[model samples]
Target: MNAQIALMLGQDGVTSGAIYALLAISIILVFSVTRILLVPQGEFVTFSALTMAAMQGGRPVRLGVLVLGLALAALVMDVVADRQRYRAWIWPKTSLALVAVGLVVVGLGLSVPFDRLGMLAQIAFTLATVVPLGPLIYRVFFQPIAAAPSLVLLMVAIAVHVALIGGGLLIFGPEGARTEPFSDAVIELGPAMIASQTLWVIGVSALLTIALGLFFEVSLWGKALRAAAFNRLGAELVGISPEFAGRTSMTLAALIGAVSGIVVAPITTIYYDSGFLISLKGFVGAIIGAMSSFSVAALGALLVGQTESFSTFWASTYKEIIVFTLLLPVLLWRSLRQGSVEDDE
Candidate 1:
């Protein structure tokens, strides 16, 4: 390949890699804080992308209905799980809050002219609609089984991933979509040109990464989450609530996933079921990190992105196989390094 082509491919790799890094970090955060592998994390990406595409196309966005329905289901779960606390005339504050947010989202989706809205408005609206699903899903699916074994949690995550795919099909239909670019500008370097959107992806990803690092290093709640990840029992004994940490981590995951979707949507077409493959790539990065170190996972994801990009150039038909094959050696090495243990469950 020529130098120009190689540079362009490298740019694509970095752009896609930034998004993968975000997903990897989100997966790591959720796994660390909650011990649940977030298989459906990619749904947030697809849903946000498709929703934005619909908005830009002047089509009505029906995501609010989902928000409302999931909110109601979560409320019911809350009541059923804690009958004594919710027996009074007043509803639980958390349930009421989510329901109210759902109603507001529904109202906005119905009342606003999304097509006429500015880019910022559409992005904000999209985030508002999709980000809440994370916490609601947590409350409905994972919260009840907080103490369950890892295998059970993984199975549940797989189920949720499947269900979300079906839900995506129902909500977004079977068609693929791409959104309008945030900008039409391009930058020319001696021999290569870069799309403005690629810069957007990389810039936003870096900012979010720095923000998260600061949050964990400087913020009290972030420290609490770290503490919980380090020692759940000790954190609870020290007055940190595991439930709060889980919900918070889920919220952050949703935000990261949604933003990733929004940023990358313009660069590629997204289908309802596309998230699984994207998230699976991110999972490879997470596994490379051994699911522990955030920096390692992000770096690994960048390598995955570069590998996938270059593989497509050389063996387009087998790019996926090439990307996935990376997991085998890493997994084998980890397995060999660790001692076997009995399952208490």
Candidate 2:
């Protein structure tokens, strides 16, 4: 391939890589803090994209309905599981807040002139409609089994992924959707012209990554999350609530997923089931880090993106296989290095 073609391919790689990096970081954050593989995180991406597309088309936004339903179920689960700890008259605070947020989002979806609204407003509405599903999901499904074995947690995560896929089908139907580009501007660098959407993706991903780093380093809640991720029992001993940490990390994951979806939607059509493969690509990056190091995972995701892009150019039919095959050597090296140990349990 010529230099211009290579440059264009590189641009595509960086754009898609930025999205994958966000997903990889989210996966690592959730896994470190909660030990639950967030297999369903991609649903947040698909749902957010579809929701934005629906708003742009002035169609009914069913995501609000899903959020409301999840909120109600989370509330019931919280009350039933923890009723002995609080007074019967007092509602579980988190669940109550989720329910309130759900109501507001639902109301907005039904009443707002989404088609007439500015792009920023639609993006905000999409975030509001999709982000809460993260914590609500954690509260309803994973919270009760927080102390379960890692294998059990993984199984539960897979189950949740399946459920969300069904929910996506019901909410978004069969059609694929894409949104308008965030900007029409393009940048010229030497022989190559870069799309504005590519810049948006890279800029937003970088900003979020820096913001997250600052949060972990400077904010109290971020410190708490760090503590929980580092050592759950120790964090609990020091008065950091594990539940709060789990929910917070899940919230961050959802926010990342939603933003990734919004940013990428204009560039690619997204269907209800599209998130699985997209997220699976990110999972490969997480594996490259052994699901522990954020920076490593981000870099690994970038590599995956570049590899996928070039593979698509060369052998379109086997691009996925080429991308996934990257995991084998990394896994083999890690396994050989660490060997196996019997479970203490």
Candidate 3:
């Protein structure tokens, strides 16, 4: 490789990794707080991107408007939905679980229209619809699962994933959809040239990550959320409602998903059924973070981005092959280390 090419690859790797890190962190947030491996996490990304693209006339828009709208909608909807759907079934365990799956299906169904709507309208509608799903899931499942095993929650998460995929296919058809990015600016800094769209992705991802980190680290509610994630009963002893933490975490995760969607839509076309791959890659990034550290997950995401970018440059046809080949070894090593740590504990 040429020296300049190598340098560019390195920079791109960091930027790509940062995006992945945001995704990974979102996954980790849900997993850590709810003790559930939320598979629908990836769909959130798709929903945000599709909605934003649709809202912006199939082009890019101001990051501030996109992020603010997504965050507000996600947070509000999460809170309301949880209280309405989940809080009502606080007694029946089996029924509550079913309700959670049903809601996932419903969310998936609602997200389908994004592919068809005008870009601006799509963003408005998606944000309006998805904001409340987080709260609904928390009220129905995570709250009741406060005393349940992680395995049970894991199964529920898987069910949600299946439901989302099935519903997406049924509603949106099998065709892939494409949307234009917001900008076409390219900047040259010495030997490296960065696409304006990619730069926007990087900048927006960085700002959101930092803001979220600060919110979780500094706010009183944020502290309670952390406590609940680590130990629900302990948080309860301190007069913090674990249910509140679960709801907040879900909303936050969804918000992150929406932001990810907005940032990513410019570069990649989205399809209704695309959630699986996106979620898988994001989950990989989260796993790389050991499912706890947000900062580390962010690092992993950038690495993934670099891997994808460079792999594409080398052999577009075999890009996936090259990426997976690299990912497998890393995953295996991480798994072994985790096993050893558990054994020691």
Candidate 4:
């Protein structure tokens, strides 16, 4: 290929890689803290994208109900847990607050109208509709079995994935949508022009990654998460709550997934099932990193992105096969190098 063609391809690859890197990090975060593979991570992406698209089109985004409903369920669970601790009134108070939030969201959705809102407000609404589901899902599905073995957690994650797929189908229907671009501006490179959204993808991904690093290195909550990830039992012994780690990790994962969705949606059509494939690509990168090393996983995801882009240019029909093929050697090499280890008694 000529130099200009190569530059274009590189740009596309880096843009796509930014999203994959975010997904890889989100997957790694959830897996590291909770030991669950978090296969349904993609659904969050799809849901968030569709939610934004719906809002942009002036449809009453019903996602507010989703967020509130899940919150209510978690509140109920909390109330159940707290009653035995002599805080029986916690349930009623939290339930009232949840009900108020749900009603406000519903009312605002009906009265304000999405098209009338500014872009910033629309983005805020989208975030409000997607981010809380993370902690709610964690509370409902995973918290009770927080101490379960990795195998059990993986099984449960698979179940959650299937459930979320169906939930996505119901929520979004079978149609696909591409939202309006965050910015239609273009930037001139040496030989090729790049969309501003590409910069958005790369810039936001880099910032979030750096922020996450700083969080772990500098913040109290980050230290708690790092401690839990390194040794759960030890973290617990030192008063780091496992539930807190699980909830926080899931929240961060959802945030990453939502942002990835919103950022990429304008570039391509997104449907209910789109998330699975996106998450799978990220998982391939995760596997390449042995699913634990953050830097390696990010690099692997960038490699996957570049491989997919170049492969598409060479043979569009075989692009996916070519991209997926890259995972085999990495898996084999890791398998051979590590062999197998027996669990300690």
Q: In TM-score terms, which candidate is top? A: 2
Cα TM-score per model: 0.96, 0.97, 0.74, 0.93
Error of 1 at 28 (Å): 0.9
For model 4, the superposed segments whose C-alpha errors exceed 4 Å read 84-103, 343-345
Higher-scoring candidate on TM-score, 2 or 4? 2
**If the candidates were sorted by their TM-score against the true structure, best first, what order would they fall in?**
2, 1, 4, 3
Best by lDDT: 2
Q: Residue 345 of model 2: what lDDT? A: 46
User: Tens-digit lDDT track for model 2 on 36-63?
Assistant: 9999989999999999999998887878
Local distance difference test values of all predictions, in order: 0.92, 0.93, 0.67, 0.85
Give the alpha carbon lDDT tens digit for every residue of 1-345 in model 4.
999999999999998888888899989989988888898899889989998888888877776777677777877777777787785566455445555666677677666788877778887877777777787788888988887888888888889888887877777788998888889999997779999988988998999899989988999999999889999899999999898899899989999998888888889999988998999999988888888998999999999999999999999999999999998999889989989856732
lDDT tens digits by residue: candidate 3, 78-123 = 5565578887423444334434544543454434544455556555
RMSD to true structure for each model, in Å? 1.6, 1.4, 7.6, 2.2
Model 1 has a clash total of 0
- Between the candidate structures 3 and 4, which one is better when assessed by lDDT? 4
TM-score of 1: 0.96
Which ten-residue region of model 2 has the weakest summed lDDT?
82-91
RMSD of 1: 1.6
Give the Cα-based TM-score of candidate 4 against the true structure.
Answer: 0.93
Instruction: Tell me the lDDT of model 2 at 48.
Output: 97
Q: Which 10 residues in a row give candidate 1 its minimum summed lDDT?
A: 84-93
